[model samples]
Target: MSCAEESGRIMVGQEAPDFEADAFVKGGFKKIKLSDYRGKWVVLCFYPGDFTFV
Candidate 1:
């Protein structure tokens, strides 16, 4: 099985596919795309729904 099939996740050093999502920036929400920051470093943060309050 490939890395994706084995863990259902991208392995370290693997490239991430381009994606778009709503992001909060500068005290406002905006739509952003992964490709927009191409060639620059980016960090992604995830939180469990149960641990966060809407």
Candidate 2:
């Protein structure tokens, strides 16, 4: 199967589509975007809630 079909709408080695949304940062909510951290290492975490082990 193609990468898109196997991985929903995203594929490896491809740039993540840009997006803007409110995110919690340093005890405050602020607008954030994927492009905001260009050229830097980013670790994205998606979970049901905090303190849950992977």
Candidate 3:
């Protein structure tokens, strides 16, 4: 990376690294490939384990 880019932390607007990873959906296991949402914004979220403080 160039000095300017390195000096500053990667910004949100930049494209995320290409990747394919697992995820939990509707209490079921599933694979969530990032490429599926190419050119679109994706908001990932998660909840804590049961009994944990909200």
Candidate 4:
């Protein structure tokens, strides 16, 4: 089975399935997978503010 089911609803308190995405690391960007950090600490942050120059 895939991470998301047909209904596309993930129940609360459930473990987040594995997924891949592009990430900025070491002065560059690379493809990363959530599972790669298994058994380790990981921080996921979301910025709601707009990027503007003053």
Candidate 5:
């Protein structure tokens, strides 16, 4: 089966849908986009805010 058929959504070698959001970085907020990091290694981490039990 093709990658999309197996995944039911995105697939290998497929471009991610575009999106924009405000991010807190370097002690400030900035607008960012997924397309901004094309051709670069990106690590996305999701976690609860500090002072809260996991």
Candidate 6:
């Protein structure tokens, strides 16, 4: 998607939205709750695809 299509995206200094995801960590169950990091700054990130070269 182009920038305009994703223009609704927010950046730094603004309050982050609540998000949650289930993930496996150290071969055990893990729950990531965005709300848990409310007062902290987070580096939210991802790769479009892990094995593909950009």
Clashes of each: 0, 0, 0, 0, 0, 0
> What overall lDDT, based on C-alpha atoms, would model 2 receive against the true structure?
0.70
Clashing residue pairs in candidate 3 (N, C-alpha, C atoms within 3 angstroms)? none
Kindly indicate the candidate among 4 and 5 with the higher TM-score.
5
Candidate 3 vs 4: which has more TM-score: 4
Q: For candidate 3, write residues 1-54 as lDDT tens digits.
A: 112122335468775555566666899988777667977878865577878875
- The candidate maximizing TM-score is 2
Candidate 6: stretches off by over 4 Å: 1-8, 39-41, 52-54
The TM-score of predicted model 4 comes to 0.55
TM-score, one value per model = 0.59, 0.63, 0.48, 0.55, 0.56, 0.56
Writing each residue's lDDT as its tens digit, candidate 6 over 1-54 gives 111122346777765666678767898988787778867867877769768885
lDDT of 4 at 17: 59
The whole-model lDDT of each prediction reads: 0.70, 0.70, 0.62, 0.67, 0.67, 0.67
Model 6 clash number: 0
